[model samples]
Target chain A: MILARGLRKSFGDFEAVKGIDVDVRRGESFGFLGPNGAGKSSTMRMVAAVSPISGGELHILGMDPADDGPSIRARIGVCPQEDTLDTELTVRDNLYVYGRYFGLPRKEVRARVDELLEFVQLTEKADAMVEDLSGGMKRRLTIARSLINRPDVLLLDEPTTGLDPQARHVVWDRLFRLKQQGVTIVLTTHYMDEAEQLCDRLVVMDKGLIVAEGSPLTLIREHSTREVAELRFGVAPDGDSHEALAEKIADLGHRVEVLPDRLLVYSDDGEEVIARVHERGLEPVAVLVRRSTLEDVFLRLTGRTLVD
Target chain B: MALDQRADDQRAGSTAPTSTIAGAARLFDYWAIAYRRTWKGSAISSFVTPLLYVLAMGVLLGGFIKGDPTRLEGATSYLAFVAPGMVAAQAMTTVFGEVTYPVMGMIKWHKAYFGMTATPLSVPAVVLAHLGFVLFRVGTTCAVFLLVMAPFGVFASVTGVVAAFFVQLLIGLAFATPIYAFSAGLKDESAFSLVFRLGMMPLFLFSGAFFPITNLDPWMAALARATPLWHGVDLTRMLTLDRLDWSMVAVHVAYLAVLALAGWFWAVRRLSRRMIS
Candidate 1:
């Protein structure tokens, strides 16, 4: 539904989005995973046809964004990173007026507003002022407003950035239902678990460049081992630091990484690695064996945590 | 099925998304609905404020000035002369008031315009809708002001009052479009106070609204004549007093029209830059 090649965005002297390529298929859940300044929002804006690309080729639904921006925008829904909800109107009017912007007739918009209020689980608050809504409720109202026109593709930028865990789960559930209904979803997020839970395919970006692109499991498999063993020792005995401890158990696993507080041993068999660590007579304070995640893949590629 | 409906709507060619005027009107619908809820807030400005200005500036003050008829600009009464100028000045103030801080709030605080652009509406449509709303406000305010002043023997001709109403709309657009352009380009609202304190207040005081420009020194009179409010004031005064100078009328109309057109284009350019990037 969306395609880009060598896409670039520059604000005067600084380029936010360096050359990159992306292709999002119809009815698929796609994500852009990166740190705060990884050009994910810039790329999303270009695809949404709201930001003009400095140099690139982009086609949304087979139409060039530069020439057919209004037409392309007519067919897609965009939930921007900021809460741009109209503070002057009620929740129902927010949806109603937004539908009118797409040229929906008054009756049609009224009907759609009621249905969307129900879809976002905001029917009870439909008549309430927008400012009175909680953060999660406002976010849901924005999502409802974006879907007023029944857009073919939905673009969500940082969909759940500031929501509580329960609220995030609520939003994720609504989005998953949308995915099941065959609406193409494009989202950008810094949370590894959000990407893993929502995106069928994703790209890891850093410093305005895409470093790796694959499904979540595939990326973890390609960049990280099947399992990891985390071991924490009590304040290291003199000269027995994390680095030294890592060196001692380095041969027990495929690789050993020394952190300030813990030592990570990568291996296909976390149980065997833990056994070997005990065999070495290193009395550790804590040990955990867990499967690798997209967080691990991102760390392996960028050498920096996603949130930081 | 939804795509099919959208295609049919586009082909129909009169809906908001497919037509510029329709789209802008649809966007304007938002403000209209909002106004329904908030119209009471503006009652003071639209009705009470203008009424009070005419009562205080024209009636009470003009009571002393009517004794000196030579300086009353050939009008039969002081209330008659200053009333229409108040209407014109009120239009200017109303339009400026609507476009300045509210325009900034739309762009920076509420992000309402950004939300409109995310849909099928274009930047020009948003600008047009907002300016149209300003025109509506100026029209109603001027109409109410004229009505309230008529009982006091201010208007000489009923048709002239109608013409003055239309001129007030032009005056509103002439100020609104340019102020909108200025407000759209601002990063913060600190400059807006400068606009009011320096730009608008000076024009309101010396723009032939209370007295004739000819009463001023030559340089200041020329400065007053150069402003849109002076043209609006002169045109409105001439119409309400039943003195139709076709030549001067054409000049005033053409000047305000040119200013409105120029500001319209500049506003569109400024808004496009802010929104598209």
Candidate 2:
């Protein structure tokens, strides 16, 4: 449904999105995962057909964005990173007027407004002012407004960035239902767990470049080990001295990453690595054996965590 | 539905309006819907405020000025001379009220323009929709003021009243469109104070709305003549008095029309730069 070859976006002298290629198939959930300044939003803006591409070839539904922006926009739904809900109108009116902007008939828009309010579970707040809504409710209203036209593709930027845990789950449930309904979803997020939960395939971006692309499990397998053992010793509570401890347990696992508070030992067998550590007579303060996740893969690829 | 089924359904639904005017009118529905909720807030300013102006300035103050009709510039009474100018000046204030802070809020605070453009609406369509709302506001406020003043016998003929009504709309657009462009380009509304104080206030007082411009100094009269509001005031005054001069009417109409056209293009260009890029 969307294709980009060497897509570029530059603001004055600073390039937010350097040349990058992307392909998003119809009815698939795709994602861009990165830190705050990793150009994920810039890439989404180009695909939204709102921002002009500096250089590249982009085709959305077999039409060039430059030549057919309005046409392309008509088929796609966009949830911007910031909530741009109309504060001047009631919650139902926000959805009602947005549908009219797409030239929907008044009766059709009215029907869709009620259906979408129900879909997003905001029917009770239909007449409430937008400013009265909580952050998560506002976000849901924005999502509902975006879907008012029954768009073929939905673009959500940082869909659940500021929501609390329960609210995030609610948003995720609605998005999952949309996916089950066969809507193509494109989203960007800094949370690895969000990417793992929602994206069927994803690309990790850093400093305007894509560093890796794969499904969550495949990425974890290729860039990280099957399991990990975290150990913290009382002798060196928090310092660079973890490097010495890492050297002591060097042969215990495939690799050891030294952190200020602890040491992470990557290996296929976390219990075996923990047993070897005990045999060495190192009375560590804590030890944990856990399966590796996409967080580990991102750390291995970018040398930095996803959120910070 | 799957992607292909959805695309086919959209094709069958007549997804977007075929013409630019249709798109803009559809977008205009937003303002109309919003106004339905808040029209009461503006009722005092639209109806009561103009009544008070006529009572205080045209009726009470005219008692003193009624002693001399010679300085009234062909007007039979002070009420007759000042009522049309009040209508014209009211258009100026109404247009500024619609365009300044609200336009800033749309661009910076609420981002309503961004919301509209995210749909099938283009930037030009958004601009047209907003200015169309401004014109509506100007029409309603001026129409109320005209209706209120009709009992006072200020209008010379019904045709003049009708002509003045259209001129009021044109005057509002002439001031509103360019200011709409200016407000869209701003980051904050701090500069709007200067627009009201330095730009609008002077034109309101010196544009022959109260006294004749011929009573002012020659340089001041020339400066007043140069303002868009002055042309509006003069045209409205002539129309209400049934004093028709074909040549001056052409010049005033042409002047306001050129400004409105130029402002329309400027608003479209500036808004596109801000929203599309």
Candidate 3:
């Protein structure tokens, strides 16, 4: 549904999206996972065809935004990173007006408005002002507004950001239904779990470049181990003492990654690695054995958390 | 989810998406919906304020100028002279008021225009729709102002009121388009205050709305005639007072039309840069 080759976006001397290749297929959820300043939103904007590509080629629904922006936009839905809901109008009117903005007939828009209000579970708040709805409700309204035309592809930038876990799940469920109905979903997110739960495939972005790309588990398996053992020493013994601990356990596991507050022992058996740590007489403040995840893959690739 | 599948079944057949007229009307549709809820609040500016301006300036102050040979031109009453100018001025106010804060808010605050563009609507369509809404307001305020002027006997010809209404629309567009461009380029709204205090206030006071521009120093009169509102006031006065100078009327029309066209292009350019970038 969407394709790009070495797409570039720049503002004066600053390049927001460096040259990158991407493709989103039909009826599947594709994700761009990254931290802030990873240029995910810029890439999404280019794919949405709202912002022109500074260089390289892009074909959204087989149309170039430079010439066929309106028509391309007509066929796609976009839930931008921020809620651009019309606070001046009621929730119903927000959907109504947005549908009409697509040149949809008033009667069709009215029917769709009612149905979308129900789809978002906002039928009760249909008459209420958009500002009065909670952030989650507003986000749902934005999603509903994007679906007014049954867009073939939906571009969502940070769809679940700033939402509570429950709210995020509701949005995810709605999006999953859309995907099942054969709508291509392309979303940008900094949440590893959101990427894992929602995306069939994703690209990890950092510093205006794509660092890694695969299914969540594939990314984890390729860049990280099956399980990780996290061990924390009491107050790190001293500021410089964690380095000594790192040396002690460096030969215990296949690999040891040190953070200021904790040490990650990457191994097939995290319990066995902890045993080896105990055999070395290193008493720790805390220890956890957890399966490797997309978060681990991201840290392996970029050495930073998804959100920070 | 079962409910959703049923809901999907209900909307199975889709109407043809494109409409020849609906595209242009899309943004106006938004403004229309918004106005439906807020129209009453605007009666103060549209009807009452214009009425009060005529009462304060044309009737009460006009009470002092009925027989003045210099100001009244020894023809119609002073009320007739100033009524249409107030209508034109009111139209300018609604236009300026909308294109300033609301335009800035659409760009920076509410992001309403951003929402519109996310659909098939382009930035140019958004700009045109906003300007179109301002024109709709100018039409409403002028129409109402003319109606209120009816009982006052300020109109020499009923058709002249119609002519003045169109001129107010022109004047409003002339101001709205460029001010929209200016407002869109702004990083903040500090310049909005300057727009009214420095630009609009001077034009309102010295634009021959109440007195003839010729009453001023020749240079000041020339400068007043250069402003869009002055041209609006001049044309409105000629139409309302039954003194249509065909050549001067043509000049006034051409001047405002040129400015409106120029402003429209500038706004389109400014908005395209902001949105498509």
Per-prediction TM-score, chain B alone: 0.93, 0.96, 0.90
TM-score of each: 0.95, 0.96, 0.95
Of 2 and 3, the candidate ahead on DockQ is 2
Model 3: lDDT to the true structure: 0.84
Q: Show the lowest summed lDDT stretch of 10 residues, model 1 chain A.
A: A236-245
Instruction: Please identify which of the two predictions, 2 or 3, would achieve the higher TM-score against the true structure.
Output: 2
Q: lDDT ranking from best to worst?
A: 2, 1, 3
> Residue pairs in steric clash, candidate 1?
none
Model 1 chain B: worst 10 consecutive residues (lDDT sum)? B7-16
Point out the higher-scoring one by lDDT: 1 or 3.
1
lDDT, residue B180, candidate 2? 92
lDDT of 2 by residue, B170-277 (tens): 999999889998888888899999999998999999999999999999999999998999999999998999888889999999999999999999988888888877
Candidate 2 clashes: the total is: 0
List lDDT for all candidates, in order.
Answer: 0.88, 0.89, 0.84
Predicted candidate 3 versus true structure: per-residue lDDT over B115-143, tens digit per residue: 87777776676777777788888888888
